[model samples]
Target: MDALGFSENLRVLRKNKGFTQKDLSDKIGVALSTVAMWETGSRRPGYKTAQRVADTLDVSIDKLLQDEALSGGEYLSENELYSRITPKTRNANHDLLEIREVLRTRPEMKMLFSVSKGATKSDIERAVAIIEALKKDRG
Candidate 1:
């Protein structure tokens, strides 16, 4: 949505990776002018080309198109956001899926899930106590 931001982001990422426009072009198999146009906001690349660019830069496509106006707090690239949103598990067991669904709907539960990373039995017991205290307070 923000073409200027995208252009600036591309330029910054390219430079950070020590890639000249020509070098990026060679890596992505695009003409040098195409990379120049993308950086100048004269043109936008297609989705496939954008993916290639992201791969080359080791960034997410969403990062390339990040809009500051729509973001809150620390800026997370698309990939980062996706990773945070998705539950990491070896298998999609029914219980895990159900837990994920509940977390999706319950902000407090989600917060506890994030805060209780590598949770010990005691940590879970403490969290349950805190949640029960809050519930009693509400009652």
Candidate 2:
């Protein structure tokens, strides 16, 4: 039963498991600061690491990362994401979840924001493909 959001749950679970932040980070293959951020609620884990955290803590994903704010429109809208980015494009129901996750994983290539104006869903798909390829290449 998770009464708190992801951060507090992570902290309590880690301590109960007798794992220091450093130890937990080592097991989950993330920087120690990343674990710190998770505990402090400064950041949330993308799909890449959420399951790893849940498994290490012996908790289900629903129990580990469940948060009220997440259910209350944590995801930004296209207008919010592209307001300063490119307002002319507006929004045509562009589900940017995958793109956002990709960008969160790769901050260096944020220039993709430039494509928001007049960017169709097809354009988004193409950008994801390109970025995924880049991810594989770098790995």
Q: Pick the candidate with the highest TM-score.
A: 1
The alpha-carbon lDDT assigned to residue 122 of candidate 2 equals 94
C-alpha RMSD in Å of predicted model 1 compared with the true structure: 14.5
Candidate 1, position 63, lDDT: 77
Q: Which parts of model 2 have CA positions greater than 4 angstroms off? A: 1-4, 68-139
Clashes of each: 0, 0
Query: Residue 70: error of model 1 in Å?
Result: 14
For residues 36-99, write the lDDT of model 2, one tens digit per residue.
Answer: 9888877888865888988998876655765533333365464554454444333422446667
Return the TM-score for each candidate structure: 0.51, 0.45
Q: Highest lDDT: which candidate?
A: 1
Alpha carbon deviation, residue 55, candidate 2 (Å): 0.5
Give one digit per residue, the lDDT tens place, for model 1 in 1-139. 4777778889988998999999999999999999999989899888888889999999977777775422233576767766644354324455788898999999998987898898999989988999899999999
| TM-score of candidate 2 to 2 decimals | 0.45
